[model samples]
Each structure stands twice: as structure tokens, then as C-alpha cells.
Target: MNGIAVAGLSQNNQSESDIQKLLKGEILLETKPYSAWGGAVTARMYLPLERSQVWQQVTDYSRWVQYFPALSRSEVLHRGDGQSKGAKRLYQVASKAFLMFTAQVEIYLKVFESIHQKTGHQIQFSLERGSFTDFSANLNLQDFKTGTLLTYSVQATPTVLVPSLLIQEAMRLDLPSNLQKMRQVLCGYFR
Candidate 1:
């Protein structure tokens, strides 16, 4: 079917509009260059799984590289005591610009994850060290009647010198694909 509609879960109550949007199989993305150094990206998509399931997939740092091709390596530097605390992760990512120039970035990030039994779950991360001078992102998951609605927002600035236009272009090309890949993997999990 084009979309999933399941009952029994209170959090899964989705609006009709949301259900239609998800059935269309289109990823909603908005991006803008905030400064010469970097930009901001907001992406929204639906996944055919519950919020808890989706949260598990996103927080499974060790498996990130397997789903996201751009990631060369993802390692958990430390696991926090609980949701109230936070965790640390290190990632080595490779991106291609202009179809030929490949650039690699190493990121050290501190992540805080929370699961609200009544609402949903959230994963917020900021750069601890690495190639980016500034980087922060929040991944929010909410239950939609059919599955889960994932909203991702990121703001970043590179520490090294890189053209603004190149950074914008790379984000335009990479983010959607990476998100789609994640969706595929999540769907695969249920099967």
C-alpha cells in the first residue's frame, strides 16, 4: 500500500493531511545559507515504523555507516548514564563535491536523547570537536497514525576553509539521499 494506517496506539493519531503527504512518498526539505561559513537544513519525512522503533534505529550509532553511505565510520565514544544525561559519538564522513572532489570530515559529537512516554522521542547533538567549528542538530520523532514522523534540523559551520556555494550544493545533494537510505533500512528492519 502507499501508506500505512494502524490502530491501537494513541500516539499514532495522524492528521488526514499528514497521511496524504506521507502516501505521496516525497521527502519535505528546506535549506538556506545562514552565513558564509555554513547553512541550515530542515528535513521532514515519514517512516513505516513506530516512534520507538525509529528511535532505536537512529540511536544505533555503530550501524550508521551501514545505512548512510557517506559515513565511513561511526563509533560511540561513550554511552551516557541515561536519557537525562547524554552520550558521545565520533564519525568520519566523506562527501563528494562537483562530482569529483571528495572531502572527508571527522566529527566528535555529544548527543542527548530523550523519550517522552506520552509524546515522542528526541535526539539532539552538537559538535564536541573535529572539522566543524560549529555543528548542532536535533532529530525529533513523533507518532503518526501510519508510522512515525521524523523531523531533522541542523546548523553547521566548517572549521576549515570551504566555499559556501560548495557546502550548500553538497547538502542539497547529500541530505535527501541519506535520509532516503535511512528510511529504506528502517523499513527493511520490519521485514
Candidate 2:
């Protein structure tokens, strides 16, 4: 066997394409490197469950802190209507540790939920008041094959003069692991 030719290919690197990007149970980092705001990330996770089931879990606002590691607290302060789909106000506190210090972000978010013609279900949130300069996120749950394609898009800017690269990295790293936790909690899958 030729070592040089053999070394040129590996299983993962060879199939790195759009078709293979969302292979079941893998997290795809869809975020661009540069953004005018702090950063934006579009993380895609393939969950082997119905879109409605996933949407039900995601719409439960107060329980978000259990799924996301960075969030220390989440509470629903108000709901626009008593129905499942509508506007609501949520208060969340997220803290990330950097080396020896921890940075905490407090935000009151205006959240909305609805059914989309294409996306199956959609949940969107924007910062009403917070420690950050700006924060907004949207979550889309779409029917994929027999399961669901969950995509989360978030843009945020910190009041502190931290680099955008750092913020993006923090988001990029946390999301995959966080979704894994959510998968286990929601789907009862363990690995």
C-alpha cells in the first residue's frame, strides 16, 4: 500500500459535503465567521423524532435551563395568550466561564411561537432588556424524512469589549454538546 496516497483520505474528510453534513445524530455548525453584530450561529441537529414532539419540548420556556449548560436560570414572566402559540416574555440568565472568571448575561426576551407552512413550527425571541447590547434568536423545527430537522439561529453582542471571535467560539462549542443533552432528555437516547 502507498502510504502517501492512503494518508490523503480519511472516512470523515472524504464525505464532507452538504449531503453528508446532516447525518443522523450529528451537529452541523452553519455559522459564518464574520458578522456585523457580535456573532451569529445556525446550528443544525438531526433529531429522530416527529417535529411536533420536538416542538412541544422546545416551546416549554421555563425548562430551557435544563437543556442548555450556559443558562443558569429561565422563567416565563408573561404569556401573550393562554394558547400554545403566541407571544410571551421570558427572563434568562446565562453564564460562561473563561479560564478563571465567569461572565453572566441577564436578558428579558420577547418570545413568539407559530406554525409555518414550510418549517412545521417556529419559535423566535428577541431581547427586550439585557446586559448584552443585542440578542435575538429563532428556532425552526421541520419535518425531515421520518424525523425532524431542528435549526437554531442566534445573534448576540455583549456589553463587554470581548472579541467577536471569542463569542462565536463559545456559541459554536456549547451548542453541539447542549443539543446532545437535549436529545437524551427528549428522545431517551444515550451514548
Candidate 3:
């Protein structure tokens, strides 16, 4: 489906019962392909843990490599303090193996973290310098019943020449696995 049509599917429109059902044992993931290129994806995942615990894992910049295994490196470039509050810069390298060829993508990101309203913690990030012409993402953690509901949304366009369909297809297939792996990692921490 085209980006505009698919982008119409967003968390804002989903009913409470619908989302709760989707949060069963797997992530609720959706992806859309842009006409020019690249794609956007949004996911809602339920973690059987407190929101604070989930927030700790995400904010610990260095540990992102664990969340996304394709990442070969993730490090803090600069950390904001005092007046800057939660501002930070992060550099990451991701290597993907396709057949016999390995492709590497490097990104420098400007990140910010804050409490959203009075209920949830949110992390927002955008590209500073990267292999992508444009990249931005948001991660939100909120309390849901006895556990945490984590939502991730991202839109990215790579600098490399690749078809929009191919990019969106890959996102559709890979994102769920990545998120499931993340859930496993988070749950493992308590066990």
C-alpha cells in the first residue's frame, strides 16, 4: 500500500480494547512505504514490567545494541546536562548481511527525553548526520494495567539508492522480530 493510505493506520485511531488485544504475546506493528522512497513504521508492544524499568533500558544509550542486534556499535557522543536537561548525541553503526555482501549504515542522532504529560516517558530522536537523508523516531513508555505499554514510531529515508517497496517490505518483516527480541531481553532482565 502507498504511504499515505497506510499511514492512516495510527495509534490515535485504535480503540482501547483493540490495542489491548493486540498486546497479547507479540507486538502490534504497522508499516507504510513512501512514494519517493523509504518508509514509516509504528509499533505497540506490551512488556510485563513496570514503566520505570522499561524506561531505564531505553535511556541507557549504550545498551541499544542489545535491542537491535544489527547494530555493531552504539555510543554516546555528547550528553546534555543542567540547562540542556535530557538532550544527547549518539553515534551508531549497523551492519547487515545480505547473502554474501555486508552493508553498513552509520548514524549520528540528536536525542531528547522527557516526561510526556504526567503519565509517560518519551524519547524523541532525529538524524544529525547519518547514512540516511532523513531519520526520526519516538519511543514512549506508559503504564498499562500491571505492566508497561511501549510504543515506537519511526520514519526514515536512506541515502542509498533503493526501491521504496523493498524498503517497506524489509521493515514489515524485520521490525516485529526486532521488537520481539527486545521484549525477550527486557523480560530476561528480571529472570
lDDT of 2 by residue, 1-191 (tens): 11001112222233445324455456666554545448777766667888878888888877788799789899999978867456799999988896568888899999998898674788899899998888889888877667787777888888876778887877777777887777778786222
Would you give me the overall lDDT of model 1?
0.73
- lDDT for model 2 comes to 0.74
Ranking by TM-score: 3, 1, 2
TM-score of 2: 0.82
Instruction: Point to the candidate with the largest lDDT.
Output: 3
Q: Give the runs in model 1 whose Cα sits over 4 Å from its true position.
A: 1-19, 82-84, 95-100
- Per-model TM-score, in order, reads 0.83, 0.82, 0.87
* Clash count per candidate: 0, 0, 0
lDDT of 3 by residue, 1-191 (tens): 21112223455465665555545655676777765778888877778898888888889889888889998899998898877676899999998774456779999998999876456999999899989989999998877768887888888888876778777777776677787788889899978
| Candidate number with the higher lDDT (2 or 3) | 3
Q: Measured by C-alpha RMSD in angstroms, how accurate is candidate 1?
A: 5.7
